[model samples]
Target: MKRPGIVLAHGKWDKPPYAIGTLADALRAAGHPVLTPELPWSLARLYDASFHDALLILDAAAQALRRQGCDRVVLGGHSMGANAAIACARRHASADGLLVLGPGHFPDWLHQQGISTDSLARAAHAVASGEQERLTLTDVFQGRPRPVRIPPAHYLEYFAADGPAVMPDNCRHLESLPLLWAVGRADAHFDLGRGYAYALAPPHPASAYHELEADHIGTPQAATALVLAWLARTFPEPA
Candidate 1:
């Protein structure tokens, strides 16, 4: 029998290639079918369409796996995608496991860097008043300046959604499902200590954390190996 299918959600502003494609290819080579959803977050106008929309995409992928004869599925993603995956598992009771790659504290990080929330507040008002469907902002992504135009409501929702509190909450929702969290050693985006603290704090039976040598964008090969090993230990293939 084949292993369960895996659904990967892409991070903000990312389509297929950045990091998910590499992981998907490796997982496929290891005999696990994978689906990388092109979420609303990938688009400019819909970039901040709320995690609920992203969950819909993930739900569709899981349903597709079931149609293809996969009994159960694992949910995972990179960056914002990882945030969506954990949130999906917390909201729905379908995922058998979770793989979180480089999920970091977006709001806190922005605040620390003085990213200027005054602008976000004004945009929020514009959205509430139906003045605009979206708003534009500039920030440094992957260490380079980039402009992001997104729905204001979505932007605020995501800001309130991600942080230290999310970990414990997600673990509570997950209950006993195996959860694997990985981050690179040089990842300036997320805090490794906090990741480990939360993963262990949940009292999850098999929750584990890994530190790779790569940076914010982790090593796909390392992630693939870790995921395969975890799958073998958590859900071995039947004879």
Candidate 2:
């Protein structure tokens, strides 16, 4: 019999079907099916439309999964997509388990370097209006890996909905839902310790934290072993 579906939300730009592919494969090998949704305005307007736009996608995905007989599920995503997945779990109270990768509250790293609220609100404006192409992701990251430029609309929508400011309160209320927060210790965009201290230990202490040595942009293959191992220990199922 197939195990419960694990809903895979990708990172940034409609959280497009990235990052979770390999993890999906792992879950599938464990007899779990996966759902990776195509978020709205992805190709052209990813940046500008990300804030309010992605919510529609999430609602739709949840409904679709229910239709396919997925009442119990897992919510998972990477980077900003990770933020969306966790929020989805919070809002819908969806999933029997929750897993987050590269999630942050306040994301001090980005703000310290200067991700202004004014700028984020502006991005929200551009997206709400559907000016996606005008968006660019040139400042999407930091360090030698090169920034992943996204359109203004996508970032705007993403910020409006899932920005660090909105995340802490939602996350704090969650208790014992088999949460796993994973990141690369070498991660540059957000520090696990400072931004996710509560997520790392007890109360919600049953949560698991794994540190991959690679930076954020590196592929899942780099840390797949640890992730799968952790998942097995934390989310075991009956045979």
Candidate 3:
């Protein structure tokens, strides 16, 4: 049997490839092909691409993996990357399984926290006025305020309360596929529990939810063993 190929996306505002390096290395060392793509949310790119564009980028990366000879593909990510993974699965439904770690980035939740409301309103105004210039928007990362410059239209695509980045909504819309959602106990979003998002996803017998002892940044490394085991069990290679 062909070994499964896995594409791991890095978190928002994180440096490319490195943010998920540890987990990606583990998967590669285990004889699985891995691709760690530099997503638009990376520190260098920072909202340069719309959410849909990011999904397309992921699709390209997954296709690259298939061309590398893997029979099955798994989409996985950390933090905001995890959000993108879920949204990508909903849009493409091509991957065999999903591996989400410390899933973050919920537009509705950010609005509730008063982080994106003002910026979203401004972005809306800019969009209405036909302004094509990039606007500086406030986003929160790990409880700290992060400012990002992005075109008004693109900003709204991500920060809108009913946007595609909403985790629970994306989960709800996901196609039926095996999913492994692992969250950190010490992560800020952990308190929301699996019921907030994971439970909303279409159920599959191989789906799982794990709570780890690590914090947000540490989740990928901490869950490496669990992820490898899940992959082995869910998509075992023929002996």
Best-to-worst ranking by TM-score: 3, 1, 2
Per-candidate total of colliding backbone pairs: 0, 25, 0
Q: TM-scores, in order shown?
A: 0.85, 0.71, 0.97
The predicted structure with the larger lDDT, 1 or 3, is 3
Q: Local distance difference test, per candidate? A: 0.70, 0.58, 0.90
Give the per-residue lDDT digits (tens) of candidate 2, residues 99-134.
677653243334454554555666667777877655
- Residue-wise lDDT of candidate 1 within 51-169, one digit each (tens)? 57768778889878878988869998887777678778777765888888877435545644556365456666877798756677644455454566666666665554343225445
- Greater-lDDT candidate between 2 and 3: 3
Worst 10 residues of 2 by lDDT: 138-147
Candidate whose TM-score is highest? 3
lDDT for 237 in candidate 1 is 80
Question: What are the candidates' C-alpha RMSDs?
Answer: 3.0, 4.5, 1.2
* Model 3 ranges off by over 4 Å: none
Instruction: Report the number of backbone clashes for model 3.
Output: 0
